[model samples]
Target chain A: MQLVTPGIGLLFWMTITFSIVLFLLSKFAWKPILNSIKEREDSINGALSAAEDARKAMDALKSDNQKLLNEARAERDRMLKEASEMKDQIIAKATKDAKEVGDKLITSAKDAIEKEKLNAINELKTQVAVLSVDMAEKILRKKMEDRTQQEAFVNDNLKSITLN
Target chain B: MFSNKYKITKYLIPAFLVVLYVTYAGLKLANAQHEVHTDSTAIVTGTETGATTHSEVSHEESATEHKPEKVDAGKLIMEHIGDSYDWHIVTIGHTHVSIPLPLIIKDDKGLHVFLSNKFHHGHEAYEGYELKEGKLINLSGADFLDLSITKNVFAMFVAVIVLLIIMLSIAGSYKSNALKAPKGIQAFVEPLIIFIRDEVAKPSIGKQYNRFMPFLLTIFFFIFINNIFGLIPLFPGGANVTGNIAVTMVLAAFTFVITMINGNKNYWSHIFMPPGVPGWLLPLMIPIEIIGVLNKPIVLTIRLFANITAGHIIILGFFSLIFIFAEMNTGLGFGVSAFSVAFTTFMSFLELLVAFLQAYVFTLLSAIYFGSAVEEHHHEEHH
Candidate 1:
């Protein structure tokens, strides 16, 4: 093994130089680096804030959608209730109109029947009267055929009137 | 004039040397434009043995000179440290150990290697290996400044440059498009950057994360490079710099200093006289807190050093089985060597993940300490 050793001068110079170099590096190079790091942290904070806002927006939207859904269900229920009421009213009115029409038809038919019966009775009476007159005429004609009858008939009639 | 002199003393030669080191190392093998195999770091151990011809036995009573009996290749191979397979593997008989390239430094004159007679195996009495070729023998009398053109030094240089290029590229991408989707190398780098910035820096230092980014990044990148460089197979970029205690110590020291400097009044007060506590308990708590502060960096240092060193030693130990089993018999050698290749390959893959992990851990610790230092306990203010 070679027992060659480094002299003291090299060590002395190296130690001295290394110390100074470190000092210069500390002074000149450290500040810029730290600034950049701080900038990055600020950017990360911005991203986190943006994410939180998005979550709130989504929650609000979900509640609004629920509210709209509830309102739509209420409106549908109201419309069905109104339509049911309208159907009942329409049925009641129609039933009243049908009953009125039936009553009017019955009344008009009764009146017509009564008129027809009266007319028929009048016609029958006239006929009966005509026939009775005719029959009496006939009877008188038969009696007047005897010559003596004409004088007697005139006498009877004069006496009866004087007595009355 | 004296203040100005103090400023000069603080910066002048030191800055110049850093620039010089970077340039000198970069010029060696910097794939700045297209950094492919330019690992962050690598560790290559050398098995340089004293020649069998003249391993002279001399008893020169100096730290530099002691001699041993002529060691044959078989014994030398068994003891050989650095890049060999044995250092990566530890078995029942042998433990993994790395022989560092004799540390070298360069100047106007040629290269040199330090002469140390300190027997690595023994603290007692022994001889040391000397260079065979006199002309090739580059020795500086100073213990540390052995300027030799060794494989490990060149690797260290190359690895550092490779790391710089990768980091610079990542920095550029960040500057150009911080917000856009990362593609190419940007994809690989951006996650690490953000993790460090958001998880490590911001939470730790509160309002002061911006002030500590560069220091954190440099340490992370430096550790990463050295760790990656240590894993490569070849010599030029294969020295485990992070595994070395000396290297880890310097990094930990930086963390300690930064924490101390940046700590506000609240931090110091909390450590010394914790709020709402009994007056009598202050004495016990204060010393413990001080020790605790010191211990943080020590842990950081040891963690990196131990992890990096262990990976290399494990790889070496597995590799040494080939030689050990080879001595057993031909059939055993072939069978053991075959299995070893498979095992080593599996481990090497794990090392890639580990390289990045170690870097991450070091950076994380530093950031945490910085965080505590600048932490303003709001309750204390209310009191």
Candidate 2:
């Protein structure tokens, strides 16, 4: 019976103490503790999201750098190709001009050689005729008796000329 | 399967009979002891020597009550569990060493205040009042209000003060630290506070959990600290603060009152005219719903009180075994002491777990009630 029974004094005191504890703790202890905990939690969440935003921004910046590098590489390749094409054009033009100049020099040299050969040939023919006439006069003086041979040679030449 | 069933019943029948016989014997002993106490108090007026001589005559089995000083295990166990006017410490021979608490009373004469030690452990009467069966009574047949600080109340005050100091200091730390990382005791208690918020209050009370956090936290720590303190077998701890029916009654009443005050329109409607019920069954269903509403607090009170009281009883019973056997033979007493000590230690450790579990259950159930009371009628939108 005593085990199950509740004393009125204890009950009275319990209610008073419990109510006081609740009221005091709610006012002093729980309010401050819970508010600070909540504030800390919100701040923690804010920091985490801020870090996430920073990481995303960094990723965007890295990609932008990659795109710029790619564009610069493409520009460099295009410039190298243009330079090589211009060098090829300049080399082709020089080779064609050199060939034309060489051809003109060869033609002029051939014409000059032809003129010199013609002049030498005419002079040799006139000198050979004069030497032959001198040899024949010396032989005629030595041999007045050969006048008949000389007159026969001239008559053969005059006959050939009249026919022509 | 039939064979197996028969085999189980072969052992079960005898086990049930043994349990029945033991309970019958216990009840008879308790009845006999109860009569002995009343007879002594009535005739001899609550004296130590008078009660002993009277008990010896009543109980014939204890032929040598005077020489050996018979140990009444039942009485000892009862005394350990029951409320008292003073804080009992120990017993040496006929002398009881205890701390006397204050007694405040209001009678037809006037308000009287004095220390409970003036009664001398119920061995004598003081002034016009007398300590009868661990209770104070007015000898002149006058009614009075007993507003004294009993053993349980003193324990409660101690528990309350300790809770205040620890909690207020922790709250102060929170103010100083602000958003910085927790350290020392702050780090230790922060997780438990968070667990109550996140696991208990949040899930049990939902979005409005913040509105009830203060109440939830107060009750949770109050019950938990008292439960743990009740397990300590020393000064300021041994009193069953949470186990006391009066204390639990008060706690449960708080939950009940809070629920009633906060009950939304949907809650009241569900009680008066429950949804999904046929009009024909309205009369039957409403009464049942109302019963269910009142039943929640009763269940909370009984659950905490019974669990803590039963734990104390079992531990005390195991300890009593040693003395009960010692009355028979010294060697047997020594032999049983080993096992008794071992079992008591094991039960005490188990009680530690029960201590935390009961507190958690009380708080969780309270939060659930609060949650249901404030719950909105979201079912309408689902259709």
Residue lDDT tens for model 2, B169-271: 9899999989999888889778878988999999988899998888888899999999989999998998888888889999999999999999999889989
The DockQ-based CAPRI class assigned to model 1 is: incorrect
Name the regions of candidate 1 deviating beyond 4 angstroms.
A1-91, A94-164, B1-160, B174-178, B197-214, B275-277, B317-343, B378-383
Which one wins on DockQ?
2
* Cα-lDDT of candidate 2: 0.83
Residues B1-383 of candidate 1: C-alpha lDDT, one tens digit per residue: 89986885587557645644553343232222213342432221321121111111111121134223322434433232222211222223334243333434344453534422222323222122233321122234332233442333334456656655565555466567565456687577657777888888888777778778888877886788778888875544456556666567778888999899998998899898788778999999899989998999899978997788778777776777765544323334455665577577878989888999999989988999999999877884445
In candidate 2, stretches whose alpha carbon ends up further than 4 angstroms from where it belongs are A93-145, A157-164, B1-69, B381-383
lDDT, residue A52, candidate 1: 88
Indicate the residue-level lDDT of A31 in model 1.
41
- Where's the lowest-lDDT run of ten residues in candidate 1 chain B? B50-59
Candidate 1 A-chain TM-score = 0.48
What is every candidate's alpha-carbon RMSD to the true fold? 18.3, 10.5
> Among the candidates, what TM-score does chain A have in each?
0.48, 0.64
